[model samples]
Target: MIRGEWQNPALTRCDSKLAFRSLNQAAIQAERASSRTGELIIAYTCFDCGAFHIGHADLSQQLAHTVSVEPGCRECNLPIPEAKKRRARACSAKAIYCSDRCQKVAERKRRAQRQMASVTPQ
Candidate 1:
């Protein structure tokens, strides 16, 4: 990836991590784009809360969901967490989490109300 030195795919294959990263990003963009066309929609975290919401990634960030169970990317259709970066090897094939930031954002939002309530004067 640093330089065009890979003259052989077998002898000098590209890093799997980097390959997976680029592929994943492209997939996300494509998924978002498709959602805008009203043909595809990815259930992304509200960023305000961890609740499941369905809306076009490009058009608007509206809240919409039919099921309590969170779904993964439509393209891969794999069970994934809200956000994750590192992919575990021995955990399970159906791992999910696009990045750690997403996971944290979701977690924070999810616990925000609870934490606020605990600190509020009752």
Candidate 2:
């Protein structure tokens, strides 16, 4: 989740959404985690206004947490194709994604029935 969007766990993780430095940090972290294969970092950018939001998610299982990540695109806070990852990179400075597929597919489901999507800060 982006800054101010997180409330649970005291929201220890929150960073800028459109900072270049942030994007680089995310790329490096993802590169190391995925063995250089590259991880998904979804970035939210507005089409009409070009405004964006950075989403935070962990692809590596090593960094496991008790928190539950509901299925959906981390950026834009909307449900999209699994192949369409968020534009945001993941890093202390900013955010990024492993692949376009992983980023986009987030929160996306193939099931006929769908569950309501919400980003509740518990």
Candidate of highest TM-score:
1
Query: Candidate 1: lDDT of 117?
Result: 79
Candidate 1's C-alpha runs over 4 A off are: 1-70, 73-89, 92-96, 120-122
Q: Kindly list the per-residue Cα lDDT of model 1 for residues 50-72, writing each as its tens digit.
A: 23344344434333333466677
* lDDT, candidate 2, at 118: 46
Model 1 residue 67 lDDT score: 42
lDDT of 1 at 91: 52
lDDT values, one for every candidate: 0.49, 0.43
RMSD, every candidate, angstroms: 23.8, 23.5
lDDT of 2 by residue, 16-117 (tens): 334324545545554565554444444433343344434444565335524676555444554554433333422222233344665456536522224433
Clashing pairs in 1: 80-96, 81-96, 84-97, 84-99
